[model samples]
Target: MAPDLPVRAHARRNREKLIATARAAFATADGTVSLEGIARQAGVGIGTLYRHFPTREALVEAVYGAELDDVTSSASALLDELPPAVALRAWMDRYAAFVSTKRGMLDTLRAGWASGRIATPTTRERITGAIATILTAGAREGSLRADVPPGDVTAMLVGVLLSAGTDGTSEQTGRLLDLVLDALMVRRGPGT
Candidate 1:
């Protein structure tokens, strides 16, 4: 959104800064950082942060939305530069990163939802769309299975990430992802 004037420009800039700093804190903190702290770290007053985000969930939505931007933007890049299967794999890797961040902010995110603070779609749908885009490309190239729905793949990945987050086991995530990928790959039934 292009601002027609300088005051709107400053508001845009302030909101961007708030989102950026809140994201860093969400990713790095022990999921305990509050809105006041986020505002302070962003070098803005609490009032300004509240004026912009209005609530914790609003700030969280901003952060989660930025992550959607990252995943979808990377998908475009991978599609432009790499083969379908390779691009899909790289996007899966980004999924892991996204899951990691999501887990870190789990508590705050949940709290926001519980309080009805953020009104936008959660990261789930956006992430699913991003995965579906890659999977559709892979299917067109005869790499991934065409029958499975993208929403199913998205649900599977989210379930895997959640389980991996709970178990705190790195090996499980890779193994589970391989199983998911198996379903998407060209079928080779029963020992080739």
Candidate 2:
């Protein structure tokens, strides 16, 4: 059992290292990046990478899935640390970063989707669910308007991001996110 445990731990570490390395490579790569290069950067042999991810598409899918999971799951974590309105704003930043990262892998992702090699993810639903979670909490706390639908917020955010484009400056994106947050926030009258 002890010997098996070490091997499993080592394999887990290798797998995580490969994924992280691949994610960085994909995020910065101008075109198709070599899988061998990813393994070299991760300090693992090419065979190890193949053992963990049988194909390039598999690795891309895994990286995409990992990013999606992080962005979606961050909603609850942020809400725990900050006010709902603040958390929602922070989540928008995370989602924007996630979108930016996809730029490097867009070609491969599009090809995979067209070829049906990669399973289509329920991306919109998951994103909407995360927004709903934050909005529900904010509404309960009277910080956000309860009348606004989460799907509308998602649509508006997508529009803001699409309009900004991948080259959008942080200041511009920040201003847009602020506008969205302001729209969702409950306003108070002067002098209570």
Candidate 3:
């Protein structure tokens, strides 16, 4: 049954708090933090945690979904506020940060994906669509190469993340992302 107004408002706050705590825990822990600890860290009761997320997998999936939602949604918003190439670069930087945060959650995420608690296709499509939107804008504005496919760019990003693994340094990731960004930019005439 649906909760009453006050109860629903309280639940929403608790859920948001839980997600915030989980994000920090997953970003720093070594993939072994407990759900009870997460609840305590969020300052919520165990029952409240279970009310929002019945299982560890559920909580992990929610965190991942929330991250993906933010990154994907920012693509268009960034484009509106900046040039296409700049927006794409900004989005890529955000994506790299998300990937770094994801490293700590790798184990739980892998298990969740294997158990079908996490839906990979939807996530993949959403990310790819976001890249496509940015690339489409870049092409229209003559800032990025029109010949390169968005899927190719998405694949490249996935490759970068996989290669970075759990221990890649920020400098290393920045250089790698710069390479990808360089590849996507339109070729300029020499000294023109």
Candidate 4:
């Protein structure tokens, strides 16, 4: 059946509300929170929530996917607005914040994985691709070292984010990111 144009806007609004509510609920609560509670918090009926997200895994994935999209999509815009290296640093900072938020979902994600509901590769690829985009721009601009592999940088960033999200403070995370950025920069031989 085709969608009713009149209801489409309403449906989108409800879906957004549900995703936002679920993100907040998952962050505050340990492990899986009730779908009914999420629907109630979203001010939508359980049927609506189920209609948008048939399973808990679906809801979790939607919330995480939206967050990933927001972070990754900024790369191009950042590159357009700032110098390559500066844009890359800003993008990495956003990525770190995204990881910090996602750290709250570790238990839920593991549970989903145990049940074979979430695929790990897709998430990894999406993030790596985003970082690659920024790194490629920096390489092309000669701001970052041409020989440094973007994938290697991505893997190291994963460690930084994991460490920061686990116990390190934001200030420490910023310092770690600065160190990574410094390492990525092309070294100048002699000043004119």
Candidate 5:
């Protein structure tokens, strides 16, 4: 099958530049980066940024979605490059780091909500699906509990973020999740 070369090519470049700029901004600014900053960094006009994302929420959505996409991609890499347990553990740790950065993103999302910016449900769903895929693989490989749902793991991780957004929460959370996973491990019956 053939497609329109020029139009598709231009769109792809714009999208890639936007995502790259957003990632750099997050890395440097740690969620304090502004929309105009992203536009300038991406070498696009504010109008063009608006054409792609009419509101701040739209831009934040792109950043969060891109981060999740990275996480999902890492899952595949970890699976291929490491054992199931190691990969899952690495994924969990990365998820923790993401949660730490996401606090500021939530504020942006709230502003977007107040300003009538539409939420991107599809992005959220894709992230959920990616985690589920990786978790299922880990469980099947006996590195994680089969009884646990990927959605549940996501919820638990998120819960940790909410509960410990301050006052040494991250420190406690790592230990808590470690214990939970330990308890949830599948053990043989007495005679099995």
Candidate 6:
């Protein structure tokens, strides 16, 4: 058992390295990136890559799932460090990064999802839940509006991100995000 432990640990490390390398490649790759290239970049052999992910679709699915998990889980962590409204804005930036990463795998993801080769994740639901958590906290703190539905916020965010496009500059994206945040913030009228 002791001997097996080290081997397993090494394998796990290799697997994680592959996933991380693939995520970075997919984030910037213009089109389909080669699996062999990914394996080389991860400092592993093609066989190791195959051992961890049997197919290209499998790798894409894993990367997508990992990105989804990161973005969804960041909301509460941001809230802990910042006010609710600020947390929401930070979460949006994270969400935008998630969207950008997804672009490289979009073709494979769509096909795999359409053919049911990959299990469809509850992506929209999970994202909406994260938004709801921050929005609820903001509402309680009087930093954000209380009347907006979380789903609406989700829809608007999608629109903003999609409009930004892959070619959109960071400044453009930031401005768009600010507009969305402005809509969610509570308005203070004349002096109390």
- The number of the candidate with the highest TM-score is 6
Which ranking of candidates, highest lDDT first? 6, 2, 3, 4, 1, 5
| Candidate order, TM-score descending | 6, 2, 3, 4, 1, 5
Residue 73 in model 4: lDDT: 88
* Candidate 4: tens digits of C-alpha lDDT, residues 51-101: 999987788888888888888788888988998899989999998877777
Q: How well does candidate 1 match the true structure, expressed as C-alpha RMSD?
A: 3.5
Q: What is the TM-score of candidate 2? A: 0.94
Candidate that beats the other on TM-score, 1 or 4, i.e. the better one: 4
Residue pairs in candidate 6 whose N, alpha carbon or C atoms collide under 3 angstroms: none
- Which 10-residue window of candidate 4 scores lowest in summed lDDT? 119-128
Global local distance difference test of model 5: 0.71
Per-residue error (Å), model 1, residue 145:
1.6
| Per-model C-alpha RMSD | 3.5, 1.5, 2.1, 2.3, 3.9, 1.0
* Model 2 lDDT tens row, 55-105: 898899999999999999999999999999999999999999998888888
Cα lDDT of all candidates, in order?
0.80, 0.94, 0.88, 0.85, 0.71, 0.95
Instruction: Supply candidate 2's per-residue lDDT for 45.
Output: 100
TM-score (C-alpha) between model 5 and the true structure: 0.73
Against the correct fold, how does model 3 do in TM-score?
Answer: 0.91
Please write out the lDDT profile of model 3 over residues 53-116, one tens digit for every residue.
9988888889998998999999999999999999988998998888788877888889888888
Question: Best by lDDT, which number?
Answer: 6
Better of 2 and 5 by lDDT: 2
- Model 1: per-residue Cα lDDT over 1-192, one tens digit each: 455688888889999999889888877876577888888888889999999987676777888888878887798789999977778777877888777877667776777777767654646677777777888888888888888888898888878887878565767787888888877888758986
Candidate 6 lDDT tens digits, 1-192: 699999999999999999999999999999889999999999999999999999999999999998899999999999999999999999999999999889899999999999999999999999999999999999999999999999999999999999989879889999999999999999999993
Checking candidate 5 for backbone clashes, the offending pairs are none
Name the regions of candidate 5 deviating beyond 4 angstroms: 1-11, 27-32, 113-116, 120-128, 166-173, 187-192
Q: Which of candidates 1 and 4 reaches a greater lDDT? A: 4
